[model samples]
Each structure stands twice: as C-alpha cells, then as structure tokens.
Target chain A: MRIRVATPSGHYRTPTYIQGKVGVIEAVHGAFRNPETLAYGGDGRPKQTLYLVRFDQTHIWAHAEPVPFCQNDRLLIDIYEHWLEPAPEE
Target chain B: MPGVHDRGGWPDVGPINKAEHELSFWEKRTDALLVLLSSADRRVIRVDELRRAIESLPPEAYETMGYYERWISAIETLLIEKNVLTKAEIDRKAEQIVEQRTIETTE
Candidate 1:
C-alpha cells in the first residue's frame, strides 16, 4: 500500500522528523478512528488517523521496533522511499 | 633550578565544593545520550557505548532522571512506529539482549 505522510493538524504525538516522507504500507494494522477526547476531556469529535509504515533505517532511527512501549506494540510511523520496494504485480 | 624556592607564600586555593557536581554529571550523561539518540542510525549504537553510558551514572541517578528514559523510549518508539522492526520481532530482540546481559553479568 502506497501512502503519503504529512504532519497531522491539531494535537498529535508523531515526531516532527518524519513530516514528509513516502512509505510503503507494511501492514494494515486495522482501522481505528477514535473521536473520544479522553486526554483533553472534551467532547470534540477529533479524527485520529493511524497507520503503520515501514521506514528507512538509514534516514531515521529512534523507535525502531525490536523494542516495546505501550499499545505502541503496533507503532504508527512514516517511512521513506529508500526502504520501500515496488509491490509485485498481482 | 630555583623554581622550588621561587614560589612566594602559598598559591591561593579555591573552594572545591562550589560546583554542582551531580547536575554536571547528569548534564554530561544526558548530552552523551542525546548524541547517541540523535543519530540517524541510533539502533546501530555499539553495545560498548550503551553500556558505558548506562554505567557512568550513579545508581540513584537513573530514578531521578526521567529524561534519560524518555529519550531512550522515544528512540524505540520511532523505530517501531516506523515499522523498522515489527512488534513481534522487537520483543524477541529485546528479550535476547536482556538474556545476553543477564548471562554476561552472572559470569
């Protein structure tokens, strides 16, 4: 799956280092759009988009899996092209 | 030749305890950790470097220094979130590292 990564608007925890990088979809963890503003204690229906992207190790390395933290068991990340390969023809 | 006798009275001595030794030590450790974390290939940091950095700290320092944990956690989070290592793979690797460390210390 081909996806474009961009800085999400509003309050987000994604690091700024991966603002604009293209990454291949390694796996579709699942669809999760949570509008529950539990942290902010607000009723605002916020759109939370999450995806797990396989990034290039050469360009960025911080939370590279092989380590675990929180529900981040499934990390949502932005990857670069160098780490991606063209999907095989169906 | 005459250097020994040339000295006047005694040289002035400064207070040794004037410096914040603990803070300074923490600053140095944090700086070193940040440098390692900032690298594009942080995961590749040699085991020696990691061990040295961790060892340089005082035992109580680890608990007091939340930033250190944050920094390391951030690095790991980035890698997993980016999918550099899958959840399962990362768990396995971390377990292996722990096991290796345990064995090394035991012997």
Candidate 2:
C-alpha cells in the first residue's frame, strides 16, 4: 500500500516523509477518533481505521545507508486508513 | 510540502540525543497543566489541539524553542483561540509577573 500524498491545511497525524511512500501493512490498529476534527473542537465522529505500516529505510531516504542493521532495518509507523490506498504491482 | 515539524529523514542533522534529563520546575508544571486541561472532567483542551497549535508555530520558533517551551506556547495559543483567555489579558498578566519578580530581586 502507498500513503496518500495529501497536504491538508489542518491538523493531521501522518508525517510528511511517509506521505506518498509505499509500505506494507504490518498490523490493523482498528478505528479511532479523527484528530483533524477533534483538534478544532468538533466531535470526532466516524473514526478512521489505523494500521501499522512498515517501510524500508533506504526507500525513505536516498542517503540512508544500511548501517549496523542493513537491509533488515525498517521503519514502522501508524497510518490512518484515509491516508492509504492500494499500491500498483511492482 | 510538509511543515518544519516533519523532519524525519533530513540529512546531516547529527545523532539523536537519547540522554534523559530531569524536568525543570516550569516544565513539570507545563506537563501537569496539559494533563489537567485535557482531563475528562475538564475537557478544556485536547492533546490534538495542542499538537495543531504547535505545528502552526512559525518555522523559527519551531526550530529554536525547547520541548516544553513549545508545549506552553501551543497551550497559550489554544487558550486564546478558544476564548478562555485573550492576548491582552495574557500580556498584561505576564508583564505584572515580570515586574513582581524584578521587585523581589531588588528587595
């Protein structure tokens, strides 16, 4: 799956680095309140599903050297469902 | 582009500082203030609101301010935005505190 590359003009949990990057879903974290609305005094209705996505460190950073933990090293982040979609076959 | 707070993979930033240090008195108070404001009983402020306020900070302040300093700054912004406090009120109160401290030092 790939994270959606959307630059919303308000509060969002997805970091900029992970946006538009391809990653594998490691776990499903269930739905939770939408922070975007909750941040602005709105009731967090209709929770969004969350997932633990894993990405290769090298894929994330051009200069990310496979140091002490080389290829096995991976970065895992929790992303909401709205920020993710199916990635095309590699 | 992501905000300045999104510095996940920037190069040449140096090693991560994992060293833990004791929280200063004001820092501890800031933490307690957040907890109290966000508590279910009060619901005065939410953690999400704080993060939003912190992210809204200008790049210079975001880059230079210490952690708790950012938190307090965000809390102040949110408080003003929510109408719980006004910029003038806070400014006047801060000036009074500073004046009191100066008087105490001289005494």
Candidate 3:
C-alpha cells in the first residue's frame, strides 16, 4: 500500500522529502478539499483522500550513506491519494 | 522552480533549527488572528491559502524571514488577495502599530 508521491509542478502539499518515496499506508484520513486548488481560492469540490504513510529510516536513505537502522524505527507522513501509486506487495 | 515552502532535501539549506524560542508578543497576536480568521462563523481563510501566500513570497524573504514573520506575511498576502485589506492600508497600520509600540516602551 505504498503511496507514489510523484514530483509534479504547481501548488502542491506533498513535501519534497516524501516525493517518489515508498511507504505503507498506516491510516486513511477520509476525504478533504484539495489544497492545491484551495491555494488559488478555487473550491476544492472533489475532495482527495489523505493517508498517514509509514516508512523505515533506511527506506528514506537507501541511496544515501548507510546508517544503522533499528527494525522498529519508522517515519510517518500525511499524503493525499492523488499523489500515490500502489507498490508491489512485500 | 519548486514551491518555496518545499525545502526538503535541499542540500544547501542548513540543518533544521530545533532550538525552542518562546513566541514573542506580536507572534502570539498573529497566532490569535489566524485562529479567528479560520475559526470564525464565516471562514475567511484556509490554512492552504496561508501556505500558498508564504510560498509566494520573494525568494530572499521566504528563505530569510523568521517563522512568525513568514506567517505574518502569509496572512497579509491572503488578506490583500481576498480584498479584505489593501497593501497601503496594511503598511500604514503596521507603521502606526510600530510607532505606538515604541512610544509605549519609552513612556
């Protein structure tokens, strides 16, 4: 249940750190108005789903230097559904 | 360029400043203003609007301004965009507030 935070241009709520990173969907926060449209004063009629995604510390720095990571260590991020894509089951 | 507010993984940007500094008096006022603006019977502004305003700031100001200053600028920007207040009026009112503060300090 990994969310695909695609790096697209324009008014976006997805933080750059979590963009393109894979994480497990820990929670579904229901639907809310799209912030990207709301930023421009337009009504975010079609609400988007927000999810709390959990990632391992090592998953975040897989490309960077290898750091000692504990199995219990995790990072959580709230992301909208539009920016997500399901990943292959682990 | 990416939104100014999205600074994650930007190598040049220094470490996250974690020092806990008490909110200044004016900062507290800004916080209160934000609450009233969004929590009032009629929602005048949304948090997304504020973030957009903060991201819309000039790169230098966006990068250098303090957290609360950023919030102030965002609030002002949103106010202007919504036609709730003009830039000139905000400028004048800011000047008056500063002048009044200085007088109160000296008196």
Best by DockQ: 2
Q: What DockQ does predicted model 3 obtain?
A: 0.53
lDDT of 2 by residue, B1-107 (tens): 67777777655788778999999999999999999999999999999899889989998999999999999999999999999999999999999999999999999
> For model 1, how does the per-residue alpha-carbon lDDT over B1-107 read when each residue is reduced to its tens digit?
11221222224535455644354675567557657654668634333234334433454654355645644544454445456667788789889999999999999
Instruction: For model 2, state the Cα shift of residue B52 in Å.
Output: 0.6
Tell me the deviation in Å of residue B107 in model 2: 4.0
DockQ for all models: 0.01, 0.74, 0.53
Best by TM-score: 2
Residue pairs in candidate 3 whose N, alpha carbon or C atoms collide under 3 angstroms: A4-A84, A4-A85
Best candidate (score: lDDT): 2
TM of each candidate vs. truth: 0.26, 0.89, 0.81
Question: CA lDDT of B16 in candidate 1?
Answer: 53
Clashes of 2: 0
Docking class of 1: incorrect
Of 2 and 3, the candidate ranking higher by DockQ: 2
In the range A1-90, model 3's lDDT, one tens digit per residue, is: 655655556678877777767788899999999999988887897999998899887777678655577767999888888888878766
Report, to 2 decimal places, the DockQ of model 1. 0.01
True contacts kept of 3: 0.62
Ranking by lDDT: 2, 3, 1
